[model samples]
Target: MPPGVPAPPRPPTLPATPVAADTRDTVAAIYRAHARELWRVLGRLGVPPAAVEDALHDLFIVVQRKLPGFEHRAALRTWLYAIAVRIARRYRERLRRDAHDPEQDVVSPARPPDRALLDAEAVRVLDELLSRLPEAKREVFVLHEVEELSAPQIATILGINLNTVYSRLREARKAFVREHSRHRFLGGDAP
Candidate 1:
C-alpha cells in the first residue's frame, strides 16, 4: 500500500449484544413498580376484594409467560393495564356464575369508627354508580377518571379508537352524575 494512502474506512463496528434480562428480576421490578396501582385497578374493575390477590397473581403469571415475546410496541403500564382488564373480567364473570355477592366479603379496615363508616359508604356509593354503567363506558370511565390515563392511552390499552374512548367517557360521566344526584336526593348516606 502507498505510504500516503489512507486506510480504507473500517466497517462500522457492530454494537455489543444486550444481556437477556433475568425473568425473576424483571418480574419483581415490574411488580414493585405497578402492584399497588394494579391492585386498585383490579378492584375497581369489579374483582371481588377477596379475589383481587388471586387475580393479580394470575396477571403476573401471564406476564411471565408473555414477557419473552413482548416487543415494546406499547408502554409497559398500558400492557399491564390490558392484562389486568382481562383478568378482572374473568374474575367478575366467575363471581357471577357462582352467584357470589361481593358486598358480603367487604371487610372494613381498622380505622376510627366515623372515618371507617364514611369511607365505606363512599366506596359503596361509587361502586353502585360504576356498576350501573355499561361495561364499555365503565372501563373508559375508570381508565380515564380513576387511572388518569388520557383518552389516547386508554384507546391503545382497550384496543379502541380515541373517539370511542371519548364517547364512552362522556356517557359514563353523565350516568355517574345522574345516579349520584339521585342517590343523594333519595337520602342515601352521604359521606
Candidate 2:
C-alpha cells in the first residue's frame, strides 16, 4: 500500500433514532399520494377488484418493512409498482391453487343503466383482452401505453432487455388491435 496520509476518518455512527414514527408518516404520505395508482396497477396485474384493497394493505406492510433498505436506485413509485406486481402475481397463483374466481362473486341485480356501468363494461372487455396476453407482453403494453412509463424504466421493472420490451409491446399492440376490432362495442359509440 502506498504511504497514505493517515487513513480517512471513519464515518460517525449516530445513535439509533426513532425511525418507526417517521417511517409511518412516510408510509402514510406514500399511501395518500400513490394508493389509487397502485390499486389500478394491481387491478390490471390481475388482482381481483374485490381483493385489491386487502392486497394494497399487504403491499404497504411489505413497503414498511422494506423501505429502510431502499437504495433509491429506481423511482420510488416504480419500486412500489414492482412490489405491487409481485403481490398481485402471488395472489393470482394462490387463488388458482384454491380454484376460486373472485369475479364470480360480483353479481348485480336490478339493472341501472348508468355511465359508470358503461365504463365498467368497457374496462371488462379490455381486461379480457389483456388477460388473454402472455404476462410479459401484457406487462410491457400496460406499463408503456397505460401507465406511460418509458421503455428504459419498464426494462428495469421487468428485468428484461430494452429490445424485449419493444418486441412485447409490438405484439401486445397488434393483439389488442385485433381484439378491439372484433368487438364492435369496443369502438366506444356504436355497437
Candidate 3:
C-alpha cells in the first residue's frame, strides 16, 4: 500500500441485483416457484381465498416492477415473504371497506388430491381464533407458526429487534393457549 493511496470501497457481500430477468419470465417463474407457498402464507395471515388471486397478482406485478431495485440483503425467499405480507395487509384493508363481499374467502392456487382449500372446519377455527389476537401478535404468530419461520429469522426478515420478536411470540402463545383451553374446557362453547 502506498502512503498517499486511499483504500477502495469494499464490494457488497450481498448480491447486487434481483433474480428476475424480464417482467414476463419473472412473473411466471415466481408463480411456479413460490405462488403456492405465498398463498398459504396469506391464508394464515387471514387473507380470504377469494381475494388472494387478485392480491397475489398485484403482488407479483409490484415485484416485477421493483425487482431491479432489490439489493438482496436478505434471502430471496424472505424478501418475497415481506412483500406477501404487505400485499395481504392491503387486501385485508379492502375487505374492511367492502363488507358486502362474502365473509369467508379461500384461494386454491394448487389443488392437493384431498382438497383445494384448507379444511373448512380448520380454517373456520383458525380464522375465529386469529380474529381475537392483537395485530402485532397475530403477525408474529402467523409468520412463525403458520409460515414456519424461526424467531431469529423472523426478526431479521422483518427487520425488527430480536427482543420484540420474542415478546410478540410470548403474547401470541399466551393468547392462543388461553383461547384453546377455553374452547376445550367448554366443549366449543367458549367465545
Q: Which candidate leads the pack in TM-score?
A: 1
Model 2 RMSD in Å is: 8.8
Off by over 4 Å in 3: 1-21, 104-115, 118-120, 189-191
List residue ranges in candidate 2 displaced over 4 A.
1-19, 72-74, 106-119, 185-191
Evaluate all candidate structures by whole-model CA lDDT and list the values in order.
Answer: 0.76, 0.73, 0.70
TM-score of 2: 0.77
Error of 3 at 109 (Å): 19
Instruction: Tell me the tens digit of each residue's lDDT in model 2 across 31-53.
Output: 99999888778777777666777
Ranking of models by TM-score: 1, 2, 3
Q: Lowest summed lDDT over 10 consecutive residues: which window, candidate 2? A: 1-10
Judging by lDDT against the true structure, name the best candidate: 1
Give the lDDT ranking, best first: 1, 2, 3
Give one digit per residue, the lDDT tens place, for model 1 in 40-120: 788778876666778888998877666655554548899999999889889878888989665465565744222432367
RMSD of each: 11.0, 8.8, 8.7
How well does candidate 1 match the true structure in TM-score terms? 0.78
TM-score of each: 0.78, 0.77, 0.73
Cα distance off (Å), candidate 1, residue 116: 8.9
RMSD of 1: 11.0
Clashes of each: 0, 0, 3
